[model samples]
Target: MTTGVTGRLGGIARHARPRGPIETLAEVSVSVESGLASDFRGAVKPGGRGRRQVSLIEAGDWAAAMAETGHSLPWWHRRANLLVEGLDLPKTPGTRLRIGQVVLEITQECDPCSRMEEVAEGLKAALTPDWRGGALARVIAGGVIAVGDTIEIIEG
Candidate 1:
């Protein structure tokens, strides 16, 4: 059942640096409607209530990088379970992803906020304008997602 985007089980090795090709097929557990969900509340335009929700990045290093800067909150604040190596979640806004049986549509970039500043020192300054990290998506189809599940780019 392995395809270009979907594959079998994979291991996730922690990286000392935030940006780099770390590993492939690293499993990221996804949970619905969390802190990321709350942050997403402000990102959506008015009358876009159903368009906001946050899913956890499985092996995210963005949170890890923030931790290195002495931000403990950001370290534990990862809504994503796995931080993938090659995929840029934020860059693919409007794309569709299929993880296990769940289907998600990337809506917008998940920008860092003042709350991130409280977690990692100067994170607000770093993430401003460019928003160089993860993103927010809405679940079009709900299903259980776990580690080792396959992620497929159904539409781009």
Candidate 2:
């Protein structure tokens, strides 16, 4: 599967590169719901939310600055299954994405917290005064996602 953006969405292609070979496939998970800061509690499930999805700005138009930093830890440093390329998700909230069989709706932009600054070097300077970085998405549908799965914009 060609897992990246295509056409006008082709912007994602700019950041994609081959991952080479792997021994086994990885399982992908998404948070059913998410919120910013204090609101995050409400978004979590009874047990707990799973891995958060993220589109690393480094893979997209922001790569220049991100590369210079030599760090994936931006103000919003979170582990995401898919490191999206060529997409600034926080800037464009409400965007819909399809990854494998899962459909995700961008709910709101994820703001950075002091914790991110401590975890990632130079992150404090990378964030805005508000410390915003990327968008938080709600899983509209659930399914398995692999490294090569296509990420398409179903809606803007």
Candidate 3:
């Protein structure tokens, strides 16, 4: 038995340079070799080592985190590659997410780092609990991913 595709890509964003501002995108190319095309992370850390090709954040969880901390910042402030909705992001490594034509494997929790504090005061603390921050994943099978694309979870 397998779960069906139940989530959608709520949003997409890219950070061109390290610590640079995020640019929202309608669609982007994905590859097992180079995560999201033109994204700085893949370029800076080429090769699929350490499972950091792409990052995903649960839209609902983000909203909760913001509401809890009274932070009204944009979703891109988290600097993740994809904003997912309608499905609980699996925190466990080995989980696979199929987004449109692309596929990603959950490598680890994209834990809230000190960078979250830079984005908003107390945000780091807010994301510390409940896996609010997001999930870090590596591109397993690659293709084009866009906003509104369907997302499927394949348990590992």
Candidate 4:
């Protein structure tokens, strides 16, 4: 139950294919059936359980991790789908967040992988604690979303 708090969608990015370069976007369409447009992970599974459809990171958390690792890098290097600011993302699953017309359900923590180290030495370790790596979410309601969109907890 998040109350009296709101966040902003600071940025949006999606990779065309697995391990592909992340493309920064000003706006994009999202769908429960396809997740984010042009994203490699957009396709829904057979059971419609696409928990990792959208990966979100807190801007402050990203900054904290970078400060810890002492490696200055863009947030895209983390390869997250969305950068949310002005609100602290909850660690608990089932927390619902809304960005523009889209509603996302937090499914789990998006664990950091070796790719982070490839992007920056020590990055993986820096993002390891306290859900710094961000959260994995499934799109429950889909629509157009854009940079500067409001991100708010829709349900506890």
Candidate 5:
């Protein structure tokens, strides 16, 4: 049997282009073709185009990284599409998750990119260990997802 984990979607963020400033959102529309409405990466990249159609992070992990780095930047600075709390994001690929009306399949680890260094020195390294950086996923069944939406593993 596939084990499951439960959590809540804590935050959402998007931007128009690479390295662009993130815009926080209370709700977002998702689709197989467009992962998150209006988000540059989502609109531009179609499903199966890449494993990183959407990205997610754990709120507690972000906090831990902040405490370790001694910097208090906003969660959007992490550049993930979703921030979740209450469950540890599975590190293995192929994990399936349900967030509100949407279902997503974990494709790979959303490894810390060099851009993290620009946000704050040592931020990249701080997020490098323990799956603190979260995971990249692709939308399987899409719909509207809102802040405070329940998150749970459908399969893992």
Candidate 6:
């Protein structure tokens, strides 16, 4: 039923390692082995198999959360890897999406953490409902993705 649905890529960001400064980029390289090469989350640790390879959030959801929290923090403050627009991010896990040449599967929600409140009061609560915190995904196929790239749900 989701066939043909599409969205636009709005932004991309990554951190070198845990709790490191986040850097926004115009484009990024993604792979099945490593989610985003520049992102520390991509590194496959001994037990980390890359299931949470990438993180994504919808612009609409972010705006709504900001409105509710009375804060206008940058999308990256949510600490997701990609910002998307237009497409409805599935609430159910296992949804697959294609961005440029990269294929990603939604593994779970990017659950809001105490880190959110550390950024702004009530932010965690604002991002709590309706998948607002974003989606966590694993790279199924490697490809280069740039800002403004088209994103689509891939139906099997």
Best by TM-score: 4
Candidate 4 regions with alpha-carbon error over 4 angstroms: none
Candidate structures ordered by TM-score, highest first = 4, 6, 5, 3, 1, 2
lDDT over C-alpha atoms for residue 137 of model 1: 71
C-alpha TM-scores of all predictions:
0.57, 0.56, 0.93, 0.96, 0.94, 0.95
Per-residue lDDT tens digits for candidate 3, residues 61-128, read 88988998898888989999899999888877898888988888899988889998988888898887
Error of 6 at 152 (Å): 0.4
User: For candidate 6, lDDT tens digit of each residue in 21-124?
Assistant: 99999999998887897798876667776778899999999999999989998999988999999988877777889999999888888889999999999999
Q: Give the range of the ten consecutive residues with the poorest summed lDDT in model 4.
A: 1-10
lDDT of 2 by residue, 38-109 (tens): 222225566654223333332442333255457753322332223555444434556677866777766665
Q: Give me the runs in candidate 2 sitting further than 4 Å from their true place.
A: 1-25, 29-43, 46-58, 61-77, 88-90, 129-132
Per-residue lDDT tens digits for candidate 5, residues 9-87, read 9999999789887899999999988789978777434234557789999999999999999999988899999999998
Worst 10 residues of 5 by lDDT: 41-50
Q: Give the TM-score of candidate 2.
A: 0.56
The TM-score of predicted model 5 comes to 0.94
lDDT of each: 0.48, 0.45, 0.85, 0.91, 0.89, 0.89
Error of 1 at 112 (Å): 0.5
lDDT of 1 by residue, 1-156 (tens): 222464322232222223322332233333344312223232335456434464334234464455545554432243332334344454566777776777777777666656656545776654544434455677676555554666676777
Instruction: Looking at model 3, report the run of 10 residues with the lowest lDDT sum.
Output: 41-50
lDDT of 4 by residue, 1-156 (tens): 765469899999999999998999999999998889989897887977898899999999899999998988999889999999999898989999888889999999999999898898899999999999999999999999999999888788
Tell me how far the alpha carbon of residue 38 in candidate 1 is from the true structure, in angstroms, after superposition: 12
Q: Candidate 4, clashing residue pairs?
A: none
Worst 10 residues of 1 by lDDT: 8-17
lDDT for model 4 comes to: 0.91
